[model samples]
Target chain A: MAEQSITSKPQSLKSSYWKAISAIVWKDLVAELRSRESISAMLVFSLLVILIFNFALELDIGTRRTVTAGVLWSTFAFAGTLGLNRSMAVEKERDCLDGLLLSPVDRSAIYFGKAISNLTFMLIMEVIVLPIYSVLYNINLFNPGLLLVILLGSIGYTAVGTLLASMAVQTRTRDLMLPILLFPVVLPILIAAVKASSGFLSGANINDIFPWLRLLIAYDVIFIALAFMVFDYVVEE
Target chain B: MKTKPRTLIALDILALILLGVSSYLALVFAPTEATMGQVQRIFYFHVATAWVGMLGFIAAGISGIIFLVTRNLKWDRVEVASVEISLVFFFITIVLGSIWARPIWNTWWTWDPRLTTATITELIYIAYFMLRQGIEDPDRRARFGAIYTLIGSVSVPITFMSIRLYRTIHPVVIGTQSAEAQGGFNMTSDMRFAFFFALISFTIIFVDLFWNRIRLGALADKVELLKLKVMQ
Candidate 1:
């Protein structure tokens, strides 16, 4: 009876830890669903970025073959920043962050919760953008490899982005702070993602694309661990 | 306020003398290269300043971690001092590299991995200062600053590796030269002497500047405290 009680204690703690994470995620999702603020902004902003790139790059057939990946990744990067800034700023503006912090849960649970929600928002935007991009450019971007790269890239981007966004919202220039702090750090993800996407779209050798996939996965793992370790420092009052 | 320490004063003078001697050794003592000629003289100072920049980069990253662990304001001062010194030295290295490249590579710039990584590192530090500027609380500013530096340091090495997927044309001086590397040259015994001397001298200079900067940071902290007291 004593052994069973001791073993069961850790099991319950583990479940409750996950419960805290999902609770925060559920709160964000429900709030976002009702408001539609972050998603609408990210979607419309990304579409505009694509339109601007069309005129700017003169994406004719030949250029499109080479630059489609670049254009798409750049659009996502800009729109990701917009969504990240809004997500954190909404918390700060209404004092939701303080209440969240006051709850009896580990701080890293907050980090994962925010990161997962940010990743979801970014994935939704990518889903909408990919089809529109394919239809307009007359290029099929539906390869399994391409989707894998997008998912991995968004995970790395949002993992770091969510951490930085939390810091940015507390600053005086909250809106301007996110991109300045984020772009240089996330350059690796953009480079690897663009390379892998282009390779898949161009029907290049699988061997050539595997290295970039490795880099994207490695980046996602390193940054998620780093952010989890240091998040407590960022949020401590 | 405390007076400047006697040791720092003496070390500053020694640094000045070493700088002059290192310049003399590099410009007059080292032989002219057959391929690059006099423009190759920039290599000595360029390499030395880049070494100093790298030293500060490591120092800032380590100090940032220590500051986060210790939660001590003194480590914050050390982090900021090293970052400032590194920022200036890296800019000098970039300009000097450009001057050498124009005559050698026939262009002002190319998107080589090292060159791009250096520029990106510079931008990251600039953004660090901008982040610090936006926060009013000193403790919060230091915390964010340390976190950002930690992030920048980790990301920079990965950035270099990712960019290395592309071919690099920058010359490999220390290691065996790749077949495709441009402007590669063999250093004579005298040139090695000058290069080593320059590296040592620049390291001393980096230490001197770092100490002075930390003292300045300490002074600034004192002023902030006094002002707060007056307000109360």
Candidate 2:
């Protein structure tokens, strides 16, 4: 903060904030795209989860319709842990995060930047999973309402997941700690997302689905702001 | 060695006595309801423990904010104490609630919002302990603990509400519920005496436990400081 030029114009201040955020986001996105480790693991693990569920549940077509949304979200949620752990692990591995910390930008900028990129990765995985799930279960998963639910749920999930992963990655029990810390905190998003997606698939009235959507939206807004406010403490040396 | 505070000792005794009285009130003073019979006795401790659980959670959350802002080790101690005590009370609350619900709901557990949220909040605090245990440096531990305490506290109410968005069968003790439900009861004046008495007595019990835990945390810090000094 001291390195921030005190006399800098307000317009320039806001731009520089976004500038720092995007730079970090770009750094992560580019690294992940090139290496392809995080998404690939997440994709494979998620498929395995769905595969296990298939054998475990023994769902026929009639049962599959109701269970599909829940299966998809659980897959996404479990897959999410993979991406968060990997992203933070990569930053910690190369000490790039410390370099980011050394910069003059607002720390919260770093938080949002990481969160958005994490959200992007999650959505990309979801996009791939949705169609695969639809084909596998023989149900349409492309409804606009369900997409919105996914977006909102993904935002909330990634927002907290990124923050918790940051803390977890620094701990001695890094791999084991993230999910234990994350799942309880992230439960609300799972509940709301699953419920909203279920409602959409079941062709419930819009009014019936609205409350769950509202819960998801509320979770996203609240947690993103919370993670923004608290990330400074988390990353502080 | 620092001696335990005499006042704490006295309060411990008083707390024991109060617990005995509260149990009597809950067990013998208030007439057992016609529906749930002896099982309804558990409600006294159930609601009381839940009340203290909430008390400790709020204290920990506030201490979390204060520790962050002031960067005071004292508040960090306060935070840990609150969280630990709350964990104990909440565990009791969950168990008692389960016991009470078993005969009525015919299962040890249902996905009722309150029950689910209590479990979630309980896990959050358990994770809080795990986070603190991993860090060796007290300062870093305090910082991480405070940050997590804040996050866990905020998420809990939302978790409660999100689950609560569905239908609830949790006994509406104070509110209007038809007399037909299994555990629902209208408090007669004697029952009211025991109910309010249990709440008041538990507040005292929570304070006493919190004071003892804080003292323990302070002593632990002192021992750590002395060990480092000896090494130097």
Candidate 3:
């Protein structure tokens, strides 16, 4: 009876921790669905970026082969900052963050919750962007490898972006502050993602693409852990 | 106001003298290279300032971690000083590199991995200051600053590695020479002397500047406290 009680206690605690994380994620999703603020802005901004690159790079047939990956990744990165800023800004403006903090779950649960939601928003943006890019540019971006790279890249990007966005919204400059703080630190994700995407698009050797994929995975793991460890300090009163 | 420490004053004088001597060694004493001629002298100061910059980068990363872990404001000050010093020194390194590259690489700039990484690192710290400036509370500023610095330091090396996947034309002086490396040269005895002397002198100068910056930060903190007291 004693052994069963001790074992059951940890299992229940584990389940509750997960429940708290899911609850926070659910809250953000439902709020975003009603408002459609972040996703809509991000989507429109990403399309504009692609349109600008159209004239800016003059994405001709020859150049498009080399630059499609770069153009797509750049759009996503810019749109990403928008979503990250808006998501965290909503929390700060509405005092939702404080309420979340006041709850009895672990601080990292808040970090994971916010990061996952941010990742979800970014992935949605990417999914919409890719199809439009493919149709507009007459290029096929439907490769499984490209999708995998996009997934890994978004995870790393949002992991760091969410953490930085939380800090940025508290600052005086607010939205302006997020990109400055995020871009330089997030360069690894951008570099690796662009390279791997280009390699897949160009039909480069699998072995060549593997290094960047590994880098993306490593970055995602390292930053998620770092964010978890430091989220407590970032949100403390 | 408190007076500057005597040791610091002595160190300042020492740094100035060393800087003067190192300049002489690099310009006059060192032999002009066969390939690059007189422009190669910039390498001495270039490598030295980059070394100092790297030292500060490491120091800032360590102090930032310490600040986050201990929640002590002292380490925050140290981290800021390190970032500021590294930022300036790295700018000097980039400019000097550009000057040398013009005559050697035949272009004012190329998108080499090292050059790109240095510029991005500079941007990261500039963003660090912006982040700190936007915050009103000192504790929160320090916390955010430390966290950003930690993130910047880790990302920079990885950024370097990812870019390095592309071919680099930047000369690797201390490492195995790649055939494609432009403006590569073997150091003569005298050149080596100037190089090592410049490194040592710049390190001393870095220490002096860092100490002074930390002192300035402390005084700024004191003034903030006094102002708060007056307001009360």
Candidate 4:
């Protein structure tokens, strides 16, 4: 951004998309790794949510398995919002977003870049929390099926969360607006994820849980496509 | 701007007449029910309000896509109008529904898919306004509004479906597994007439209100423009 002077050069579509996307994702990853701000905050917040639910709920051995899915999904959802709000706020504060917008790369590269980084942070939090939940509850969440559901669910959550978070950060309300705006939109993802997780945990038949999976995939695809197509409008000067 | 359009006048009166006739039919034309009796009358307005709410939701979603493509503030006005109208209609529907549920289901509320989804949709609508209000830039506000509306539209249907799935699988049908778990009723010819009439009338009423709201929005825009000019 040092050379804020307008460049008349046009960035080619194909190369800019992948190049800028990977660069943005890598930047966010490296930045997060060093500062440990967004990830650590999200991770600690998720653990606290789990801890609160542990005391708030009376999950006896019988009811424990049934509820672990709900507890995990809600914790992830709240933590996802935390990560999204911080990630976007950081960009706004540093003028990094302005720098990116001024670049020759396609605007969508920025969207994908931010979304993947946000998703990575959420998944990392989940990776840390799931085992803790499993150990505390004596529930086995190691099933590959459950893991897949978590991935699909986080994808849907982050895709929409990233878009909404971008808007929320620009608003005067900032972080508070993120959850209020994100929760209702990301509800389908949360519901589908929780149901699918429960199905997997309960050893429900694969045929039965297929609809939830389809829902997760459908939501992830629709929102991701929408965010890509519309990110330009959202970020336009 | 000096004189009101005759079509607007006619539409306003027509909406009034339709509402009167629809209420008459709902209250007087239809016979009393076998099981529920007079309380069933709420169904007419309840169903109509819910229908209008859905209409507004769809209109908002479409206007959002249009605004995003055209970057036109006009479509953004339409989006806000539809959302606000739908919010009012949904509020009525929820209240009337709670009233209807009291005697029939012996409860004020149930976590039915429709009920829960309606509440969530209303919350989204409120959040939409909050999001818009927090931004000072008009263009950016409209842009963000459209994006959030689209996101809300895409997710609500899936929310309904997921809730429906959970209900069917878990079956909160209490002890009995009867179809009447949520108060099923067979509509007679007269009740059917009233129900359908309510739906048709509400659609017209929604359009009428939508048109008026847009006009109000235009006036508001004018005021904003004048205020800006004065400030400059």
Candidate 5:
């Protein structure tokens, strides 16, 4: 029976493949928009982090200049972790992940869909935090280069974050496992992102900032390809 | 049990002899560095341990691939043995490096590339154990362990590259390049021979220990199955 299906209708394969991807993405987005539970939790968690950083780092005028990028990015990174862990845990809890796996969809499609949804939640929280941070610190963080850095950093961050979180959620200490499993591996990305963003914000030359951007891009491409290829192993029952 | 496995007993005696000779060559035979005198001797074992650690890492990664291909538990045992020994040896390497660094670099730690990679690789192995701990089923544990090791092996190099780039932009004081060029004396021919020989000797020791540990794992699995059957 499986062999007969393989022999028949190979052309329909390409279209249904994409159809599966969009369906998964659409499912996550619609569910998120209706419930707003994941985004709201992430958004609130990010604000609390900024608030704590403001007081903890003594985000004074001078300190803010140095720490603004670090504080903001770390906040997003931490809260983005919350969203990723919950995102996977929710699917696993609802048995939706199993259903998705059982469907005719390609496994990579599920990876992309979850990654895209996770990236969206992270970006939304970052977007909200940016304006509040700018208004609070009175530091303009709206620069194009800085925005580019954020996008590249988040892409790389979410690419690996989703993969690791999927593994973590299956573990006994699901929620606690993500950060422990993640921070060490992704240290390079966070370090480069903060440095590059700070450099751009401080009006450093493009030459000074370009290498970091290159690192971020390289990380994003490598891990994205890695996650795509290895998604099969991770999600297989 | 078959009478103590003559080959392993032979390997053990050989390893001990080589290790003793290597230590003597490193400490007494090799001439001391003019700048950093006694601490430099630690480099012989430090580099040797690091080399063995790398060997274990490669073994674990290959075992991971083999496990996935064959879906066999024996390769999983090989993977765990490699990771555990690699973890221990890498810890020794890192500490010995620190001890050597203190008198030589005047700091206990420097984010040198090899040192940083050592730390990251240690973390990777620790995570490997943690992932295995989380699963109850042996098969699933083995699968996840193999997959994580494969992913980690690929990522660790990229991690090293990024850190190296960071180091280039901000070269720490007492890094290997400048320290060797400035303060470190040239290695005598005897020292060079001992150094490479120490690496080869440790490689053999690592293989012997790895075989023993894999046997231990197999015994543990046997006991676990027996316990399960008795409970039933």
Candidate 6:
């Protein structure tokens, strides 16, 4: 390996921090693509939830529009939780978390990196489920506004989810604790996303959707900032 | 530590007297509400306890932050004290709210915003203690407890907003508007006197109980350290 000269500039350190985050996110995505364990479990679990909701709610086309956003978000929330708990659990179980912590990178880099990977899993699940749901219910869920809301919601959800999961995974009751810890905190994002998504899908007035969109954005900003600032405490040894 | 300080003793006496007077004022002094009659008297204690609960929550969050910043066991004691008192007061608040709700809303429970938020806030604190229980290392437990309290402090308000928004957007088709919806009468002159007195009395009681709880925490810590030293 070439001997890279050590740099003392703060800006370089900052850039490298982002680079490290991207690297971790990339690693997880590549690993997940090769193994297909986390997403597969999440997808199957989500499908089952939707199936149960199918029988439970009996969503015909008429009723589906009203409930589509709720069912989809509920599925994402549960499945996202599953993915998050397992993702961090995998890191802990394999002793990868300690190794990553020992790396010569900022801790927030690892926080963001894991958050992005977890967000990717949730977003991918959302993307795959939407099409199948649309096909089943004869409704197209490919609206741009709805997609934006999903992205914002997922970002906010995964931001807190990743932080809380890190803490939960350290506990003796690791996996079981994440949902109990995450749900109450991340509720605003879920509410706004479902409300906005439902509005966009049902062709409701833009005015009805604007408040939810704003709420989603606000939650994303607040929680992502909060998670990033406090993540150091969460993952500190 | 200093022997159970004289001020706390004085305050304890004051608290008991205030509690007695406040109860008398509420039960006998305040005029009977027109609509729900006597059960409405629970509002005096209910609001008093709720105020104490909110104060405890704020105190817990502040102590949690102080503990994290200073890494002192004193702040941890404060945190635990606030949580314990808040748990007890909030429990009273919920029960009194329920009792008051029954005759007013004609239901034992309604998923009203304040009621739901109170329950959720209670659970958050409960989970805070559970998180603390799972960790054996005092330092680590303090650290994690502080972090969780910070998280709860921010999230509770957002939770309240979301639930309130949900209710406004889609209200219950069947149930009457919550207890608040039952057109609660304005406080009469005597009722206001009783209410304010109850609030002040509970504030004193909270301080007394919190001081005792902090002493208990310090004693527990001493015992834990002693046990560790003996074992070693």
Reference-based TM-score of each model: 0.97, 0.95, 0.96, 0.93, 0.92, 0.92
- Comparing 2 with 3 on DockQ, the higher-scoring candidate is 3
Model 4: CA > 4 A from native: A1-16, B168-181
- i-RMS, each model, one decimal: 0.4, 0.8, 0.6, 0.9, 1.5, 1.4
Ranking by DockQ: 3, 1, 4, 2, 6, 5
DockQ, candidate 3, comes to 0.90
- Report the candidate with higher DockQ, 3 versus 6: 3
Which regions in candidate 6 have their CA more than 4 angstroms from the true location? A1-11, B1-3, B166-180
Instruction: Please give, for residues B1-232, the per-residue lDDT of candidate 6 as tens digits.
Output: 4588788889889888989999999899999988778998888898899889999999999998898889898999999899888988999999987887766676788776677778888888877877777777788888888888888888888777776765432122134544334535667778888888998999988988898889889988988888999999
Candidate 1 residue runs with Cα over 4 Å from true position: A1-11
Report the CAPRI category for model 4: medium
User: Pairs clashing in candidate 5?
Assistant: none
Output the number of the lDDT-best candidate. 1
DockQ of each: 0.88, 0.77, 0.90, 0.80, 0.49, 0.56
Tell me the TM-score of model 5. Answer: 0.92
lDDT of 4 by residue, B1-232 (tens): 5456789889999999999999999999998988889998998899899999999999999999999889899999999999999999999999998998888878888888888999999999999999999999999999999988988898899889888875532123225454425566778989989989999999999999999998898889989999999999
The better-scoring model by lDDT among 3 and 5 is 3
Stretches of model 3 off by over 4 angstroms after superposition: A1-11
Please give the RMSD of candidate 5 to the true structure. 4.3
The residue ranges of model 2 lying beyond 4 angstroms of the native Cα positions read A1-11, B178-181
What tens digits encode model 2's per-residue C-alpha lDDT throughout A30-83?
888899988888988998999999998886898798888889899999999999
lDDT (Cα atoms) of all candidates against the true structure: 0.93, 0.89, 0.93, 0.87, 0.83, 0.84
- Could you give the fnat of all candidates in order? 0.89, 0.75, 0.93, 0.93, 0.36, 0.45
State the displacement of the C-alpha of residue A236, model 4, in Å, after optimal TM-score superposition.
0.7
Q: Compared with the true structure, what per-residue lDDT tens digits does model 3 show for residues B97-208?
A: 9999998999989988999999999999899998999999999999999999999888999999999988999988887987789998999999999999999999999999
Q: Of the candidates numbered 1 and 5, which has the greater DockQ value?
A: 1
Lowest summed lDDT across 10 adjacent residues in model 4 chain A is found at: A1-10
* Per-residue lDDT of model 6, residues A102-210, tens digit only: 9999899999999999998998988999899888888888899889988999999998899989988888778877888888777778878988888888889998789
